[model samples]
Target: MSLNEWFERGISKEEYIDSLQKHRDNFLHIYENFSVPTSDSLSNKENIRTIVLAEEWCGHCMLNIPILLRLTEQANIPIRFLPRDENLELMDQYTVDGKRYIPIVIFIDQEGNEVAKWGPMAPEVKELVEKLKVNVPTKDSPDYEGAFRQYVKEIVDVFRHDAAYWNYVYEDMIKSLP
Candidate 1:
């Protein structure tokens, strides 16, 4: 019924690691062999600190935490974790329409301003990836670097969308982290 229960029933750490490894291998292969752009040239130049409001017992939180961890690794971003129920006052700072969604990801700029917020939507993989690709230039464009940044941003965005992809990304991130 809970997120931890779902994880226990669906995937063990070993299984999660194995799947993540496959994704990492594939990502690396594509990254190295393909001419896909890198995220070094985006317009949003501010460094962000992410505040993840979630509960370990939440299914969505269980699924998205791993992906968030992975994106943090790949992007070298810093994140602070907080339990949604336990941190009610703090969680109020990042609610959408006054509702506290588990795994709500808040992006704060260097100035501590809330730049963007996303969550409460659980899109499938194809939709998630497509959403990422939006507003990003094509690889054929001269501004490939900028495009790549958008790609990276999209990857992070996808993690916020749902639990399955989040779980996949999170498993890989956990293995990769020190």
Candidate 2:
């Protein structure tokens, strides 16, 4: 199917948020409090729509999707949510290193041609995640699973409450727009 057809199949923001189980509160928290910075660059955008490839269970998606929602809402752009697992046909096109990533937001023109895309993490956020991963033990180590879970928890905790990280995501997303 074409990108436009895939986008048409996506759920609305209300449906997507309502269906969220794991990060519904986190999503709400961000949406309620975060504000998009004024951007002349975003002011004149016309005939643009955004499609988000995400899964509710993904921590990265949990962190990024809400911000995107707030951004698109403020910018007056139409946005749709396409669950990553159910829509791998489209996700497959946006893979990194042959692996899929969640919370990839694509901006498409009226013709459904991609203008730009943002995903997975802001550069600063990615650096922080890499730093956090440095201490996780290998699979052979007995503490590996526990350590990894702890790392995930730590990242989510930061992602949920840190305005700096949220700003990083917002700024990067703004840079990604047409």
Candidate 3:
């Protein structure tokens, strides 16, 4: 379904936040940093409409989509969500490295042409995740899940403490208009 249909289905931002479950704390920290101004002159500057493909249960989705929502809401740019799992056709077109990734956002111009897309994670955060994924032990290891959870916690701590870093992500995403 399109984002309009999703919104009509009551898959709202509040519901998505609640569905974060154990990941809500980390998302809350990020959401706090995604500051929206009282007036955003940037709204409709490029006349862009956005569709966010995401899933609430996704760790990466919980982190980035809230930021996307904040920026779009501030800009007064209409935005919608389509669950990545249920929308394979749309997700396949904007895959991260040829694989479906949650929170892949598609931007459309007023004339119905595609403008740009962004997703999965912020750039620096993606770099951190790549490194952590390699270093963290797999299920074959006896204490695999524990080590992995620790790594995940470390990343979330970075989000909580590193405001400047995440701000860059917000800026870069907004500045991507062309």
Candidate 4:
């Protein structure tokens, strides 16, 4: 499925926007002094670029895309998106050692050197969702801190242990993005 289809399946535009708002609010509440990193800062005088390679059908993408969008918005960073299948040549240019994975986010520095790459594991998404569901805020319950920490840990693990896939996907993702 495509990104549009994925968005449609997971939530409506209105819902997405609402979730973004909620996410922003929650983020701000905890990080009032936090500032989104600028592209310049991300690159540290190098030209830093970000690319997102994703398919709409991916549940992991569904969960993480919004967070990325929100982060970029807050940080005032520019990002580009490319469909995994549509940009085959570009994919070849940056694919993670030939493996194809959806929803890869790549960070590239000015020298076109890869800085970092991250995405989800096929097994981890369900676990993440289950954990998130348990921590989602409600009138009777609110514990975003724990949930956020867990979420970060899951993401960190993806990059730490899954280096090859992460690197390949990140390379492809960065190449395809604007």
Question: Per-residue lDDT of 81-136 in model 2, one digit per residue for the tens?
Answer: 89888888899999987889778898998888899999878999989999999989
The C-alpha TM-scores of every prediction are 0.45, 0.94, 0.80, 0.41
Which 10 residues in a row give candidate 3 its minimum summed lDDT? 1-10
**Winning candidate number (lDDT):** 2
Candidate 1 residues 26-141, lDDT tens each?
33332233221254232233375566666544544544555555565456555666557766776676677788866676666666666655564445543665666776787788
Top-TM-score structure, candidate number: 2
**C-alpha lDDT score of every prediction, in listed order:** 0.51, 0.87, 0.71, 0.49
Model 1 residue 144 lDDT score: 81
Count of steric clashes across candidates, in order: 2, 0, 0, 2
lDDT for model 1, on a 0 to 1 scale? Answer: 0.51
Whose TM-score is higher: candidate 1's or candidate 4's? 1
Off by over 4 Å in 4: 1-47, 90-99, 121-178
lDDT of 1 at 31: 28
Model 1 quality (TM-score): 0.45
Score candidate 4 by lDDT: 0.49
List pairs with backbone clashes in candidate 1: 66-170, 67-170
Q: Residue 48: error of model 4 in Å?
A: 2.6
RMSD values for the candidates in order, in angstroms, are: 15.1, 1.4, 3.1, 12.3
Cα TM-score of candidate 3: 0.80
**Cα lDDT of model 2 overall?**
0.87
Of candidate 2, the 10-residue stretch with the lowest lDDT total is 37-46
